[model samples]
Target chain A: MPTNKPSLKGKLPTELKVMERLALVEQFLAKLKVDFEAAGFRRNRLVNDGIADGLNLVSNAVELLAEESYEDADRICRVAWIRAHFARAIFDAEMTEHFLGEGVFLELDDGGTTDWRTFASEELAELQEEIVNLRKQIKDRSAKRGKK
Target chain B: MIDDVAKLLSKWLSGQRSNKLMSTVVEAMTEARQKVRASDSPFKSLARKCIDRAEDAYQEAIYQLKDGEPKLCFQHCKQGLKYISMAMLHLSDLNGNATTFAIEQGGADESIIDLSKAIAAFKTSVEYTNCEVTVEMKERLKESVRLFFLAVSFVEREDDNEAKRCAHGGLLYVYLLSKESEEKLQSNAVDAEALERCHGSAISRIVSLIDELSDTNSTLQEASVESHGRIKLYLDAARRTVDRCISAYLDNESDALSQLAKAGMMELRMARRLIEYAKYPTSTAEPEEEPIEEVDQPTDNFRGRVARLQRLLRDEDEEVAVVRRLGVVNTYYSRARALFASGELSEAERYARSAHLDIDFARQLLLDKHATYSDLI
Candidate 1:
């Protein structure tokens, strides 16, 4: 017990624990840099603007963290998180349109028909399929119960 | 070429139907001239002419209805109603004896005819006559006419919801007319017995039709949640439109009323979108994280990192600033990793994404070293 072996029950000094956390934070950020490069989000101007603004807040939080002003740091980090969240949402919405085409997105957004005749025909087909599925479900349930 | 154009114009004019109201007006004028020559006073003759015009309009309305033009029919009926009221006022004015008779008679009898009483009965009726008619009365008549026609149009379109809305509005006008009549009686403006004899049955019929239409609409609207929402939207839109129309009527801006009505219709369409959203629930791929909930009592390390990042960004040197900014990104990334290790996937994704954004921004700033503070700002 008196040997130099680390004990599970022992608590690390506050300074050492903080240093460990800082190192972990650094490693995590390095991995994020790699993820961003892979995602090709660097080419997005709006995202770049968001990140720049976020970094400004993040850097401020870090300084507060170093000074042990944890509350202020947390506030700044929370704000940065919100900024980043909104930026990603905007990017994702745009990406969806790019991949799915505008016409499909418009239909989903407004529940309107581009061509009423075509839409009516499609709706009729869908209704027929739904009725068939409902009938099948009823039959299966009755059979499972051994009903006459 | 000029001769050909003239011939074309003549052909078009020949093909067009004559204005129904104008035709009725001409017939009325002829009848009025004949009646004035025979009658002791021109007032009674003029009233007779109004009645004739009203009858003509009514006949035309019947023809329009047969032709499947409910809106036109409604307009004709409205004209008929207006003329009928005017005729009553004229008859009342034939002798000052009408008001005196009304005062003497107590029951609801038609014997009482007082122009002043009729004017006082409805605020709208007050505006239709100049010394003989009130402009307010004319405006109310016009509004009633519009509402009646709109209701018929909705019915013709097979839009029961909108039809009901319009019918209800028309009914309100009818009720106002009745109320005005009653007030006139109360103030001794007209004999109560006279009003009952004159306008009672017509008012009752209009009220009954309105009630029936309104009930039918309610039942239809109640069939489903979606229908109910639709009905509510239409009713609310109609109410707003009517309010606007009233204001426009008061301002005497008839043209503006049409424009406002169009705007109201546009707003109704927009509200339909809100109704759709309210009726259906949207789906999200992933479960939402309580990021805010977690931050209510943030951990010590989280606070420390935030503080450090804030300090780093404030550095004067651009290079140091970039490094510190990167460090801030790292802090969030580290938090995401910890959350990920704890199996909080949604929270982890959120933090990780934020970290990625910061890194990209920092890289961009580093690449554009020549960018000034003003550019960043």
Candidate 2:
């Protein structure tokens, strides 16, 4: 029997949760390919043909994870996550004539994101300490800006 | 032929004659076009286009004069002179004959200095304008500077005709910009306030939405998480963009700051849309029911007050001593707010106290000496 894959749905977002979410997205993409093939879909003319372009990102993400490139993997996964969700949204709301592919990926490419709350417990404490130091910076800049 | 047009254009541009004489100015340009038509110069067609523009402006000046808008008439005359001079410059460039049109301003050295000061003032005035206006202003300033520098280089090479032409171009830019700056100064400062308010409002809206979504039920939690990620992502980018804007501000970069601010605002808008969608998937009806937070109102009021006070002071010939105190008040308030946001209450309170004192002093001075400006107080 296959074990249940870790997922981010219905849970708080954190570093660990993000990692698990990446795994979940990878698993979904795999399942989607299998299901698409089993449903006797053609090679190129599927109704959701646009999603096929996004499949390479998942494999690239898996490859990055295999190389222990956590940061790179996370970046790619975040982009994939943004694109997948965005495409899914458009597909749901859109007319049958509208197609998704490169445009969806292109728009999401510039979303270089930083999840502010994602951190381990120990790292959170360290981050708190750094926040204190960063507070000084905010004060300095604010004071400078405040000066006539 | 070009010399006669340049001389006539120069005299017409001096604003010394009755506006009715503008017809003669157009007649002269029409005569010049006939000369351009007769010339076998390789670039005669280009020269004709320039002279044609010159004639149109002179025609406009006549209408403006008839309308009793002398300032506008003067401006139209200057525009006419600019194109006419540009034609002379082109002709001089083509045929080795120097047909320089004298501009009604400082010499090359003085024009360069004045242009620099004018461009600087233009930048300050432009911040009160919309992003598109600010961008156009920047491009004009850049082109003006380029022309001035080329003029300087021509002066160095002893090419009097080219130097004069470039300096004339630069002077026209300075004149136009100064007029624009005056208009911007006269216009209400509310526009600048509205822009900053829009930005601050977008930020706080996203912040409050994130807070609410953090407490949402499990069924809604997944969608909230996705929205949360996007909001944080956008806010992070906006912060960095703001940092770039500040750097550009300090460095006085004409082009970068507006573009950066635009990009930052775009990011904020994206996050705001995401926050709405995440909070209510497929339900447009709910947002109308949700109360829009007016927390950004305070910041808007503060910044707007500062901007208005600055504009208000410009009209006052005498420097009001207490006016400087408002700057201190604004600074202290901004610092206090920043400190308060970062959880530094005691430090914030200290700044807040200073702000209160300054505000009280400025208000008292305004009430005592300038009763008409009580609203700003």
Candidate 3:
């Protein structure tokens, strides 16, 4: 009988558990490699299937941020973070059709996104007054921020 | 058991020693990239020198280990460690992201995964280090383990207060290691209270730092006497606990290596915390223009900024203080923009100059304050 090899798995960290998942995916791909190639899976084609759904979520987030949709922006912000992580994982796996599902994308309460344009005059005025207090030190960014 | 211990020590040393070489390779590649990015020639010579040193140390360490001179092997390991650290420093200087280590691993979660790996490695090194090595050998292993902990902690996100809470758990991990090693060496029960105190002190110091910043900002908002007292109270409590832990560790009867290893690890964790503070983003709203006469009056936000600046400056860390000052200048500039909008041109000009001067001051202060573990060595 062959001598038993050291069980390195027990010594590994929690992250290695994910690696096992990837390994399973690899094993499956190996069997499907012939079928995949025969079925017209082009090796050169970068597949991003359901990823667009995820990307759309993030894209919507970027839009919300640009629109100063704070409440919506905040909700999308969390989604975008998850989307970015998922997109990265899918990209790593070289999969085309990975995307936003209920399990993948945690739902946030629907609310009006923050509209940057709606900086209430009171809050804006208060911020301005505070700036006046700090005085001469803040002028450094006038050119950068485009404040004439 | 002796052979097993030696084998483990040799393996640990060799792993670190190889990393030293790998770090060199990374440095050379990074340096070349930097030169390409900036079209600058400055890093090329330094990179070449580091590569040569790393190669020499790499060869020497392997030869010594093969010859079974663990002491020589250890020294060569240190040499390799130095070169790797130098490479990392160069990479940091070149504006490489901390996450690049994992990114180069070819995946998104790799960075976090690598962090987990590093934590696991340190934990294993500590667990197996029992009854196996000489006091000196234990110290060396502990030092390497501590360094790895710092490397992991450096990647922690600061702005998420909850993340900070989770991040300090790594510090507790190190404290446990120290306690475990102490128990093994001294054949006495490790003081659970002492370890607990260290963990408690670290958390309290961080929390107090946050509280003080909040209070300072609040006080400055009102420019009130009560606010100042609150800030003072928080700072005093934080300082007492932080100082007591530092003094206790330094004065302890533990062997120099373990004590120093523990202290260095703790300091690195503290440094990481301060670095996180420096990098934390603030609200980026563009302040509207306001009048100069209105500039002298403090607001809650203004006090918050002041409190943050004051707390940052209070950190004994030079780099942290320097970076915080730059942020303070930026905050001032944001205010100036608002002032200028209100036609307070004179006040805006003053704030602008102050921001510039503060940036210059920060640079000087950082140069004076910046230090590394090599400095302790």
> To one decimal place, how large is model 1's interface RMSD in Å?
41.8
Q: Give residue B47's lDDT in candidate 1 (0 to 100).
A: 56
Q: Model 1 over residues B128-211: C-alpha lDDT tens digits?
A: 221132343343433443343343333334443443343343334534344333324233222344334333333333333333
Q: Find the 10 residues in a row with the least total lDDT in model 3 chain B.
A: B98-107
lDDT of 2 by residue, B4-81 (tens): 999767666554564644655676677677767677754465457667767777778879777766666766665565
Model 2 chain A: lowest-lDDT 10 consecutive positions: A104-113
Backbone clashes, candidate 2: 0
Top candidate, metric DockQ: 3
Runs of candidate 1 with Cα error greater than 4 angstroms are A1-46, A101-148, B1-377
For candidate 1, write residues A8-110 as lDDT tens digits: 3323224223222222222223233344456662245434544565556554554455455654554444344433432343344434444443312211110
Q: Which of the two candidates, 1 or 3, achieves a greater TM-score against the reference?
A: 3
Our tally of clashes for model 3 stands at 32
Error of 2 at A101 (Å): 26
What TM-score would you give candidate 3 relative to the actual structure?
0.24
| Clash list (residue pairs), candidate 2 | none
What value does DockQ give for candidate 3?
0.03
Candidates 1 onward: DockQ, in order: 0.01, 0.01, 0.03
TM-score of B-chain for each predicted structure, in order: 0.20, 0.27, 0.23
Between candidates 1 and 2, which one is better according to lDDT? Answer: 2
